[model samples]
Target: MDLTTLTYIVVGFTFALYIGIAIWARAGTTGEYYVAGKGVNPVANGMATAADWMSAASFISMAGLIAFMGYDASVYLLGWTGGYVLLAMLLAPYLRKFGKFTVPEFIGDRFYSKTARVIAVVCLIVASLTYVIGQMKGIGVAFSRFLETDYTTGLFIGMAIVFFYAVLGGMKGITYTQIAQYVVLIFAYTVPAIFISLQLTGNPLPQLGLGSTLEAGGGGYLLQTLDRILVDLGFTQYTTMEEGNGFNMMMLTMSLMIGTAGLPHVIVRFFTVPRVRDARKSAGWALVFIAILYTTAPAVGAMSYFNLINTVKPGEVGAEASNLLYEERPDWFKNWEQTGLLAWEDKNGDGRIQYYNDGNEQFAQTATEQYGWQGNELTVDRDIMVMANPEIANLPNWVIALVVAGGLAAALSTAAGLLMAISSAVSHDLIKGIFNPGISEKGELLSARLAMAGAVLFAGYLGLNPPGFAAQVVALAFGLAASSLFPVLMLGIFNKRMNSAGAMTGMLVGLTSTLVYIFTYKGWLFIPGTNMLPNTAEYWFLGIQPESFGALGALLNVTAAYLVSKVTAPPPEHIQHLVEDVRVPRSAKEAPAH
Candidate 1:
């Protein structure tokens, strides 16, 4: 079969499997809908957590970021991975022991203030909504390319799939479906990596292949070869960090780590297990599953980058005959061009694509004067690198089709998780907890499904006009989570004297500061061109990008909370005792009711 038919078959089968799982595991009650009835096995929950945690940002965009940004993107890998460790070690078991259905519920009850709970719900909704937009964008990109639909149409199809499984199954259905998704995504991710690794380095393991010598051409170490290739094209060396970027990188990494811990969707995963001990066990298993892809990402990024450069510049950099002829471009190039993610312009009427760094004035001058190149003639969206990698390598039609399925699975799995967090915050935390304490369980469950449907529509609309590529948008979401939620959650759990006044104040301060900074650069509410200042280093406060400002915002949150709580009355004695109780290990049966 041709590639298009095969993609339809593979993607169709995965979708059918997801909906079937959702039907089988459809939730029957509030508990099942919110926390999978608290009966999930540790290993199974771990796999499900992996699927939920590794969104399109991880599967579709991280490698792409690594390919383009080189050493600067290492922060994503470090921050996200380290942040999970922070969650597993510092937060998960304690939160699981508190035995709440949602993060906002824990906050409200812990702080003994409904206002605190409402603020947390707002934070969760904002962060989850922002995060889900990235997933929607990834879905759109995959569908637009493989299904031959427009971006908006593809996004709607993805939204419908999410609505079906997420609304019907809730956490119960999503958990089981995510397990299958994890398998599909991991297989799809690794198979291509392994194939490309062997092809490039004569090694089957992508991890080892990254450090191995190139099996063809000049036969240098892979990193060295890649570095030389990039530098020759006026790009920064692939393995070296640019000077003056250290601070931004450090802040970005810290933001991502704390943001990971604060994300309500991932935190809720811990609540699915039956016991606190199981939460810890599941966290360990999740780390293992997550590491599988994280470790392979660098190799995939580097190899794909190498392949891309080789294809575009066939022989030598800056050589008149080296540039690939526009009409002779590979099928993958034409395919992506139709999606508008890849484009070429014949500057200087050379009839060849010149893709060097036009921003490097020194190199641009030389290219124009010596090589008769006018400017950079190609625009390649970084988000397309991973999805297009298999095709670029001329992999089998089935492999390319499998990649489409994997990208959709990664995007949809996290989209479901985030929508769950948003819906639960609205229905369980806002409606049942605050507005209508006497609401019936059935009513709340129905409200949760309706909330999810609404969230899907809102997120899909934002996906139609994303502010950035998949991973950059996700980084902004992480910043929101880190600034708004992580500090308050940590204080609520670790500080016995932490009061409602302090918790509420901290959340508002962190969230407001971070959002304002982000809006000033990323546009108010992420509407493009609404930003008051240019999103460049020269315009940044202390050279901190909006995405890296979360750590600073989090610090402000902690400091503000501390000062505010010092003058206020401490928590009630019982609340302090409750905090003490949560710190100690106990069975789920022994945990006190919220």
Candidate 2:
């Protein structure tokens, strides 16, 4: 079959499978809706958590970022994976033991104040909404390319699919659906990597292939070859970080780590398991599943970049004939060009696509005077790299089609989890916990569904006008979570004397500070041209990028909470005792009933 038909068939089958799972796993009670009735097997929940945690940011965009950013992008890998370790060891089991349906509920009960819960809900909503927008962007990108639809139309189709399953199944449906999604996405992701690795390096394992010698035109270690090619084209070497970027990298990595631990959607997955021990077990299993992809990402990124550079410049660098003629461009280039994610202009009327770093003035001058090149002639969106990698490598149509399904699966699974978190915050934490304490279970479930519908619409709108590419947008969401939620959650569990006044004050301070800093650079609410200053490194506060400012905001949160708690009254006696109990280990016989 042709690519288009195969893509339709594959994507259609996955969507059908997802909707079927949703129907079969429809939640029947509040427990099921919020935490999958707290009966999820640890292994199944681990798979579900892996699917939920690895959003389009992981499946679609992280490799894209690595393709363009080179070594500087390693922070994302380190930060996100390290952050999971923090979540597993420091937060997941303890929170699961607390026996709450939501993070806000734990804060409220732990702090003995409804006000604290409301603030926590606000933080969760903001972070989750920001994170979901990236997923929506990924969905749009995948659908627009593979389904041959406009970006807006593709986005609408994705939104409808998510609304149906997420609204119908809740956490119960989403969990099982995610397990299926995990299988599809991981298979889709690794198969292509394996193919490209064998083709490029004669190795079946992408991880090892990255270090192996190239078997094609170039006969050097893969990364060394990539570095030479990039440097010859006026870009920095691919294997080394640019000078002066170390501090920012460290800060960004720290923010991502803490933010990962603080993300409400991932934390809520732990609650789906039956016991605290099961939560820990699932976390370990989730890490294993997560590692399978994380380890493969570097290989994919390097190989994709290598393939892209070879395709665009087929001959010696800077030679007139080296540039690929615009007329002779490959089919993948034409397909992506139609999506507007890739474009070309004949600078200097050369009629050849010169994809190089025109920003390097020395290189630009040489190209202008010697090579008769006017400027960079191609624009490639980083987000397109992974989705286009298979086509760029001339992989089979089925492999390409599988990638489309994988991208959609990654985007939709996380979108469902995030929407669940948002709706639960509104329905369970706000309406039931505070506004209408006497609300019936039936009413609460209805409200949760309505809240989810509203969140999907809002998220769809934001996706239409995303602040950045998928991974960058996700990094910002991580920053929000790190600054606003991680500190408070940690304090609530570990600091027995932490009071409502301190937790509330810290959340507001951290959230507000991070927002102001981000808005100052990223624009107010991410509206283009609304930023107070240019978002450049030189203008950053102490050289901290907005995405890396979360650690500082978190620091401010901790300092403010510590000072405030010292002056204010300690938490009530029972609340203090509750904290102690939460920390104490329980044997199987002593475990609390679900």
Candidate 1 lDDT score relative to the true structure: 0.94
Which digits, one per residue and each the tens of the lDDT, describe model 1 over residues 413-437? 9999999999999999999998999
CA lDDT of each candidate?
Answer: 0.94, 0.94
Report clash pairs, candidate 2. none
**lDDT by residue for model 2 (346-383), tens:** 97897888988999999999988888888998898888
